[model samples]
Target: MSEDERATAEGMQTCWSDSTPGEIHASFSGHRTLCGKPVIEANPIYASRLGDITCSKCGGIAVFDEGAARTRVREVLDKWIAKGKLTPASATEMGNLAIDVFPGRAFTSRRKGHSWNKISTDFLLASGAATDKDASARFVGELGLAVFEGLQASEYQGKY
Candidate 1:
């Protein structure tokens, strides 16, 4: 089989236990989730569907309780505050970043998929790349794996 075919046959990647945590939301700050290597996100599909989940930014793999999520947020804020990255007032302003989401609320994002137009993933799986059921959609400025995998370096004429 072809390389792309081989990748597609392996199916979407459901395990995020081995991945580095990505951003929780693109709307707010670009803080990292405390997943590190969380297990619940090993099966993102299952995690995202549940409530009272943790805020690991692992999306489908947050395993902590609400209290834990709150604590985690505080910890992150503390670290940032100490580093001068955040102040008490700024932290309080974005207090609900990930601390308050739980117990019927899940901290996850849209599914990861692909598109021919590279604009929507609702149509098909990403060729030569594993689909992440829990990963947030690829944002601008970040490299597009599917687009980059098969192209020549010289082909990057300032656009994908």
Candidate 2:
């Protein structure tokens, strides 16, 4: 891991109930989390992709803090600006690029779910915990997907 990554992980270690998240069920049962989002079942096809329960909005508070992520995004933006690939006036565009790294809900014939593959560094130069360079895009992309899937799991701890 990189120095910055090590520092952030050490600083804000999550308070999960176990080394791995618990509380997944075999089927959807219309249960709702404390935060009111309908608890969803583990997407078996991708369960291997996640690490814990989601809906922590009510299961627990994650604080939604992105201090380190913001710092990195700005750093990437500055580099892009310096390369003349962007401009000082591109603050709005920079913000949009940053936001694009987050996974969004998607629907398939079977169910509605987050698009983990979409959360890559190809379009976004940086996220709250990831970055990209031509030489590191592959590793960064995989890491970004893993981090996002874990976040998805933690965010939905309401129950499967």
Candidate 3:
């Protein structure tokens, strides 16, 4: 028999099917030993992808489309600026940082090379928007929320 036939006889098999829009199908394959009790495990792909928008490896279901995320982040920053929580210049800086952090942008980079947290902190310091520790923490927390909302929104749209 051919290698594939042998593998099938040995209880190894693979299957593929069409996935919904904005998603991909992936599967795992491994050996299954009877005596040694070899184990095989598989997990469903639980993340969505659209163009450059996708969940981080560790982000699980989190996902975001580039344009929508950028617009959402900018709107949140604008609200903060209007409320006097952040200066216009600081808001602009934060908006720029968001653009860089989100996927589908040329500036997108992993946290290793360009960390969103570090960039937000630096922007706050340089812009003098939230120099105090408590204030800075709160500001960063707000940014985090904005990002989360953007991601969730994208995921919802991708599903339907």
Best by TM-score: 3
Q: In the order shown, what is each candidate's alpha-carbon RMSD? A: 18.0, 13.1, 16.5
- Evaluated against the true structure, the overall lDDT of model 3 is 0.43
Off by over 4 Å in 3: 1-63, 102-133, 156-160
State the displacement of the C-alpha of residue 62, model 2, in Å, after optimal TM-score superposition.
4.9
lDDT of 1 by residue, 130-155 (tens): 35443232211112322222221112
Worst 10 residues of 2 by lDDT: 103-112
Put down candidate 2 lDDT per residue, 25-80, tens digits, no spaces: 11122243323344443343333222233433322222222333444455555665
Listed in order, each prediction's TM-score against the native is 0.26, 0.30, 0.38
TM-score of 1: 0.26
Model 3: residue 159 alpha-carbon error in angstroms: 11
For model 2, the superposed segments whose C-alpha errors exceed 4 Å read: 1-64, 100-160
Per candidate, the number of residue pairs that clash is 3, 8, 0
lDDT score at residue 125, model 1, on the 0-100 scale: 48
> Which residues of candidate 1, in runs, are more than 4 Å off?
1-64, 101-160
